[model samples]
Target: MNRLGVQLGSLPWLVLVTGLCITGLWSHQQRSYRQLEHERVERDLAGAISQALTSRLQSTIGVLDAVVGLFDASSAVTRAEFHEFYMALNRRGDTLKGIQGIGYAAVVPNNNVEAFQQQVRASGQPDFTVKPAGTRALTTAILFLQPNDWRNQRALGFDMYSEITRRDAMQLAASTGEPTLSGPVRLLQENSIRPQVGALIYQAIYGQPDRAFNSGQDRRNRLRGWAYSPLRMDDLINGALATINNPALIGTSVLVYDSDRTKPNNLLFDNLNLAGSNKLTHPTWLDVTIANRTWVIGIQLDHRSLNPQGWSNALLLQALLGASLSVLASVITRQLISNHQAVRLALSKEQEVSKERALAGTVFDSSPLAIVVTDPNGVIVQVNQAFCQLTGYSELEAQGNKTNLLRSGRHDSNFYEQMWAAILNKGYWTGEIWNRHRNGQIIRHELSITAVLDPQKNVSNFVGLLRDVSERYAQQEQMRFLATHDQLTGLANRTLLIEELTRSLALARRQRHGVGLLFLDLNNFKPVNDRYGHSTGDALLTAVGQRLLSSVRESDTLCRQGGDEFVLLVPDAPELKQLVAMAHKLVQLLEQPFNELANGAGSIQVSASIGVARWPDHAHDADSLIEAADTAMYQAKHQGGDAIATASSNATL
Candidate 1:
């Protein structure tokens, strides 16, 4: 009996060991599967990003080819002709993706410098003269840059041959007869206020019309000029990233390096937040080939943003359940072996198992994710409390209904057909989807749908898990608005104004309509600010913005051109008299006293000096129109205050 008792006790220990071994192996396999799955997902994401970046670069290079074609078709292209070509193909077209500007650079000899300057001066830019104007055997001077706004204007007349980086790229393109990308460098157009890493792509234009660039000697003898475009590295990278569908990439770190070198000096763009030694997770490096040049792109995943969906939680729950079952089995075996009178106690063990199953059900019902279960026929069978709370539907109302009942109508029938196809083919589908709540409000949710199968491999049920993400989308849109508008006045900022002006000018040119521009400068504003403080000045600016907004037509655009400066663009202003009357009205309105709310019982009177310029009359382009208006505004200021001035008719546009 003693030997039998020892064997009986050893049986329980043996069973416990076997259970532990089985659970441990299963857990290991689960972890390994997750790791492998993660790696595959990472690789797929990397390839998608690489393809996007490559496509943008190729498209940008194609724009350079179009620029080359323009020069090839003409023996000598004027600034206006080049500007028109740029507008037709770039500004008015969709080919210029993230390119700063398409510009023309003419190669002039030392003896021809005076003649070149004279030629440029006659081409509408009276101040057109080459910069870094040292005497050289040959110099490549920027002759024209299209969509000539304040930023592009800074690069006009800049001598590219003066800089070795630009010179090297120009020489390479001339010799190869291909688009050559420059190494990382700071653009001449950038100032201390807005510093950005810049690069240039140059396509060579040969002097001999029919000669091919076969050798270095041939290139040197025939090199006439270069058609190039400047690239802000951040703009190019962001443009590429914008095409990606990965939401996890928003906070991910990206680093681009020149020539496969990862050093700081070779760094072209870095989007990482490296403050306080913040390290990246799962960093990867890839070689991106663009126009025969290799750029090393480093991508780092934000592990915190990674989705822990599907099998992870289920694996954990399974492990916990297996371990509990093993413990319960061991206890029951030991109790039964000890005494025959423990039959009731053994039944209690079964009760405990039932209680554990109930605990799992409780966890499912209490989960944060909105989970809904539907039968094989696509009828809702059950839903968790979270689902009820999120969809504003009671369990009683939701049960027996179809998933289509939650459709927001934002998606069409085709979208649903494609979604069902994917789920049927792959057993699961996850994406950002729109659904409607019972309150009739549309909600954006990150949703995952899984199909469960029975022992016969037939569909048993469909389970959906969702988390609301509408607030996140709204916040992203708000951030975009804040980036382009003034916080104080809620009017468009300089960047937005430039874009609007470009679009409006392009439209006017197409329609053969006139565009009127007005530049307004407030008078006696600094004195009021000096006496009452900046709060009063801010109040005055906001009030002025409101008044200006009310005075303009709904189609017109009013922009805060910084500080006390304001600019207005009026479309289809066929008559200058209308512009003059509008300017006078604005001046009269500003001449009224402003009640300072910041200072109780305080009032300050201010006036505005308005300058007006019209397109196809005072100016030929957006840049020229703005310059004319600015020049006239100074004239108005000189003539005292609260006056209106038109651009000089005698001045060349």
Candidate 2:
């Protein structure tokens, strides 16, 4: 047969083969695309649900924090005081949707139960008596519940420590000094006829003596009471779902279980009223940590809502179109196979190049570091998403502008010159630089610049990348300050004091000015430490330091020279009379007794013996000046404490 006749004879078989290929490809692509769409939808829905749940819990916790603050500010939070606080907070428009009421539970000893009950009865609850009124070593009684209604009134006088569920969570709160959540439990407010599952969140409050809540032991020793709130599970779930009530959540159900052991016995709340819906085909479980306890929230989606209805119809239409085109394609292939082969190949190559360019564009836009591409003349031609985000300038605004628009003036012209020189000589430069944002804020950036070259070894363009390093730089400076400062007193340590003294001496020499130095030693401080404790001694020292600092001139430097010793440097002094007057004022201030409440101890009495020295007169160097001041200080102590003496005018010390 001739060539055209042979092609015509094989046309039917070619159409069958082409139809099979189209069916297979279309089936695979449609399945993959549907799967991706389902995953994206599920991810978005789950994220929304999680955020709502987190916000709901956080709001309730905020109310509990305010209640704790009230207890901290008062010596004893009376029922009337708590009621007033509750009414004020309610009027502030800060309402927790799922919270039943916020309350306080006082930690009472067994011996004090009768007194506590008498006090509660005196506070307007005539019939109030402790529940489970048996003698225990320690008891926690709910003394006050806000809103003062019948539902919340039932919780008052109930000892939460008598029940294992509440007691466990209270102990955890007391130990951790953080809010804690109880497992599934029935609240006292719920009636036997129509009971609701509930939980409690508790936070411990300590007295003033407990300054360091460092560990569980410390918390246990110092805990005075608990501030807590009650939660109804159904109300909590409803509040969480209120914001996300849409088609995606229709017919869906949610269940929360305690501690990941999801069973009927452990169920905290269940929104699904139907039995069969509990056995979901695809269920997602997310774990949330609230108040130091884990809660597993199960999201069972409605499978019927996810049906691929329109996609199925579209796939059928696509198959019909594919089969019809197969026959047309077979006929066209036989007539133009040789003539159009090169053209089709060329078109395929062009499509592949376009795809490559698109992939590169996606990567460029998605990069985390700020990226800018400039023409050979350093004018910005292109910018990425991160660059726009960093500088607060859109791509349209930044395209025609040079990078010099970001100069903060913190770097001089020579700095830019050096940067460009490095880029030109080595083809790359990397360092820290200051840049200005569009909002007029100066920011620190770790920047890198590279010279892009053409194939002929000629410069074509430049690429720059920047990352914000402002926070890191601030942290470094903070660390440096801490290293040179005393942690206890926040005064200059030995390292910094020596540096300042050296600088001061050098300046005084050039100006031909006199420097006066004084050495101060606290008297009778050891007796205070021995009678009270080191804490009391430390407080006394702190008080004396503050007094000295306030009494001195702004130019003077008062350095804590280790244990109970202090040195004051007075520069630009022309005579000794001013230094003597300052020494007497400081001694008199130190003579005053510190209050017990303010110092956290009994009243303390202390005095200071001060010695004075003149630079280049009694001493030429820092060490000689210090030695002269020390000898004079001992002379003052010998005469009597709280006296000031100057360096001898003798030949030597």
| Per-model root-mean-square deviation over C-alphas | 10.7, 18.7
lDDT of 2 by residue, 1-653 (tens): 58887876687568768776977688668867865665555556666776787787788788888888887788877778888787566534336444568898888854488897887788787888888889887787888887664457668888999899999999988887788999888998765434778999898888874377667777776788898988888767665665674556655667678885446667877766532453654556777787798887666565544533224534655665566556545644554444477875675466556655875686578777899999988899999999999999999999998999999999888898999999999999999999999999999999999999999988899999999989767855664565566544777755566677778898999999988888888888767766775566666677777878888889888888656878888877667777777788888988887774144555678899988888877888876777788778867877776888889642111
Clashing pairs in 2: none
Error of 1 at 254 (Å): 2.4
| Candidate 1 global TM-score | 0.62
lDDT of each: 0.78, 0.76
Q: Residue 479 of candidate 2: its Cα lDDT?
A: 46
Q: Give the alpha carbon lDDT tens digit for every residue of 214-247 in model 1.
A: 6788777777788888888876776676667776
Instruction: State TM-scores per candidate.
Output: 0.62, 0.47
- Off by more than 4 A, model 1: 1-8, 90-93, 110-112, 275-278, 307-318, 332-349, 354-471, 478-653
